[model samples]
Target chain A: MALTASDVTIHFGGVVAVNGMALDVMPGEIVGLIGPNGAGKTTFINCLSGTYRPNTGTALWQGDELIGLSPSALLRKGVARTFQNVASLHDLTVLDIAKLGAGVRRDRRTGGHLLDFFRSDRALEELLMESILAPLELNDVAHKPIQTLSYGRRKAVDLARALAGDPQLLLLDEPVAGLTSHEGMAMAAAVRDVRDRHGCAVIMVEHKMDVVMSTCDRVAVMAAGSKIFEGRPAEVQADPEVRRVYLGEP
Target chain B: MSTRHIAIAIGVAVVMAVLAVVLGRYGAYLVNAVAIAAIGALSLNLLIGYCGQISFAQGALLGVGAYTAGNLGNAGLDGAVAILGAGVLGALVSALIGLPAMRLRGLYFAIATLAAQAILEYLFKILDPLTNGVSGLVIKPPSIFGIPMTSDESLVLPSLVLLVIAWLVVSRLLRTDLGRAFLVVRESEIVAKGMGIDVGHTKLWAFLIGGFIAGMAGALIGFANRLASPEAFTLDLSADYIAMIIIGGLGTWPGPIIGAAFVVLLPEVIQRVGEAAGISDILSALRELAFGLLIILFLIFEPRGLTALLSRIKLRRIGVVPPAGLRATGEGSQSPEGRSR
Candidate 1:
């Protein structure tokens, strides 16, 4: 397993946000986490990404413990995540955000990083546009400020930023939730393409069942604050308890 | 960089050089004052405008530079060495102050800086041995290879050169990853951290860089006036520097220069107007009133500052259409609602 998260748990006031959430993801695999409203799917992903510290649990990525590490530290450890709501920075263009992502990547090949102080990152800018932005159809507005991009495009830019970092474990929160059907499909395809190219493990928290079924190799279903079912997508859809709690079958 | 930006820079440089050569002694002195003020404004902007960190202690940091330069110069150190020492001290002091305070957000940070300003001011007066007990120290004119640059006319070219170098260094830094990291931290520390940026370290860098630049500005001021006085760098001076960036526009490269020139030259213009009208006494009182009123008006009508106003006019003249995203009406101008469909 590239990532093994065991007994991960967190609480907010009296309510449990996540309870004993355990997951294992192999390299180059996509695991979709789906749950109803108030389920702990997003909360579990947050725990793994270092956004929130679980009250008790341990997540090991490549055999290194990830508890108590900061988000930046996680990124340095080759774990990166995309936000559910894309960040629309003032005065920064799409290309600029992607470049920011490129700045944090752990496996930089260059020897003299400080030499970057003297020259413009025009080469990185071009490469990002070609590899990351082009696939998402964001190249057209690459130079436009993120605040000026449409809702769907900004989300794409957020994904572009995450991909630019070349993470070993990618955590995406609703990557295609706000996008059009066509854009959603394209985003799903792009996610798969990135996994194939980078051979990185992925844990995606999503509400859209169609996208998850098509994109995820494995699926986990959550209810309240614990995992209720874990199986292949077809098996998850077929499970009676999952159908009762999540799918709302009579 | 764009050709248009380069053209504008070169044109501005030529105009300033020509003005330096053609102006009389008093005009040259005023120009030197504005140049030094511009450097300070630029430094403040790096924190407040670019990094979104509020600081009310810039004037104190400027004093630190001035005193360092003054003491070193008095000890017979070379001018370059004195200025460099000031920058080093400024960086160290700012980092030390910022380490604890940068964790505070918004108004809390501002208040912390306000406290720093008061503390530094008291130190300047209480540390009598080094600062001469508020009597202040006179700075000798700097020399370059045996040539003394004492007169205002003689110093104008050097001041202009220093301003140009400052501009180049800042602009180049903005083009690098470090600059983008500053912007990310400004936008949201949570997001910045998620993106692998060390928020605390980035904020520290902002303060260090800002203090160093402000210190250099102080050294220039000391060189220009031949004095490093505590009274010259009061809380009011810090407020004025903040107003310069706000009125001139924030985050834009040329905003601070334009703002400093406006702030420094406005009083002289008001005084001259008063003299011409034979009502100098009344105009002196009106100076403060005019400054306040102008700031209010700019905030009301052009909250984005003079840079946005200029850009709007240029965009109109060029007949460029606004982007589709901006054309959306109402709350759509804000980032799309984070709601998932």
Candidate 2:
């Protein structure tokens, strides 16, 4: 398995945000985690990605401990994630954001200061630019600062940045939560395309049923922070417990 | 970056040197004072402009350096060693201040630095043995490499040379990895950390660098005056350094120089007008009032500074259409690609 979380739980004061959540994602697999609003899908992702410390249980990536690491530590260990809120995201071009992701890898071995002369070199930057942006069809606007782009284009840019890190596993927190149906399908196909090209594992946290059902190879359903169902997307669609928790008294 | 840029810089230096020779003593004194201020202002720019740390301790550090230099000079340490000793003292004091104040942010950071200034001034008052306190200390002028530079015209040459050295340090830093990290930290500490930047260490380095430059400037200023006084390193002087960076444009290579020239020359020009009109005190007050108003106006309307405005005008003049993202606002848009994700 590329990544596994066994019996993970998190608490905020007295409230249990995530309770006994178990998940596994294999290499090149696109696994979906879905639930209704406030069901703690993001909290689970945060626990796995080192944004929050799990109160109990273990998170492992290829048998290495994934819990208790800082976000940068996780990033250096070959895991990088994009935030849902995306704070401090001003004035940077598409390439610049991608360069930040590229910066993560550079800082891993060489201290950032020493890498200045080579990091932003034209040839290497162009290569990274092509690999990350061309897949998202963002090559045309690569030089343009992200602020000028449409919401859809900006989302594409964010994805490109994550891809720039050359991550072994991508934990996408609702990659297309508010996108139009066309954009959603494009994003889903792009996710699949990235997996195919890079052979990276994916764990998608999403609420869109159409996206989860169509794109996910395997689906896990959450109800009140615990994994209530896990199987093929078709099994998840028919699970009575998932329906009762998400779709209301079935 | 290119050979052509270096050539042009050398050409400018030659012209400035010729101008100093023609203008004589009074002009040299003006140039010397301005050069020292520029060095101090540029150092502060690294912290305030590039690293986004708002500090008002430049003047206090300057005072520390001057006192150190004055004391050292009196003890027969002489020229270069005395100046170097002063810089070391400034760095040590600055590091001590940064250790606690680094934990504070925003208004708290400002207050902490202000308190540092107050404490330093108090020390200067209470410690009469070392500092001479209220009476201050007067010393002989420096003779560099056994060459006596008694006249203002001769002093200007060395001061200009120091300014050039300060400029080189700033240029080298802006192009280095450490420099880019400084910019990154200023832009977003969170993002910088994610990219494996040690934010605390970076800020400390900034404080040290700024202190070192301010220290050097202080030594020069004290040497020029042939005296070290507590009043010379007041909060107003710190505010003036901040003003220089703001007017020049923060985070740009040329901005600090532009800012230094304006702040240094403004009072002189005002004094000249006052002399012609036979009204000295009113002219001085008018200059102070003008400086205060400019600070307020720039902070409100053109916070990105003179460099940003100049860039916009340059772009318009060149008829190079701004990128769609850059067109909406001069500061760039909020959270752009990162926010959407």
List-wise, what DockQ does each model earn?
Answer: 0.53, 0.31
- Clash count list over all predictions: 0, 1
Clashing pairs in 2: A89-B335
Q: Where does the lowest 10-residue lDDT sum fall in candidate 2 chain B?
A: B332-341
Share of reference contacts kept by candidate 2: 0.36
Please identify model 2 stretches exceeding 4 Å from their true place.
Answer: A88-91, A106-124, A138-140, A180-183, A247-250, B1-18, B68-92, B126-130, B137-140, B143-180, B188-197, B311-341
Choose the strongest candidate by TM-score.
Answer: 1
| TM-score (0 to 1) of chain B for each candidate | 0.90, 0.89
On residues B1-341, what C-alpha lDDT tens digit does candidate 1 reach at each position?
34555566566666776776678787788888888888888888888888888889888888988888888877888777777888888888787668665568877888888888888888888887667758887888887445577888877776677777676667666666778888888788888887778787778878888888888888878888788778977888888898888778767778888888899999899899999999999988987677788778776766446765666566567996545333211111222331111
TM-scores, each model vs. reference: 0.94, 0.85
| Candidate 1 segments whose C-alpha is farther than 4 A from its true place | A106-114, B1-7, B318-341
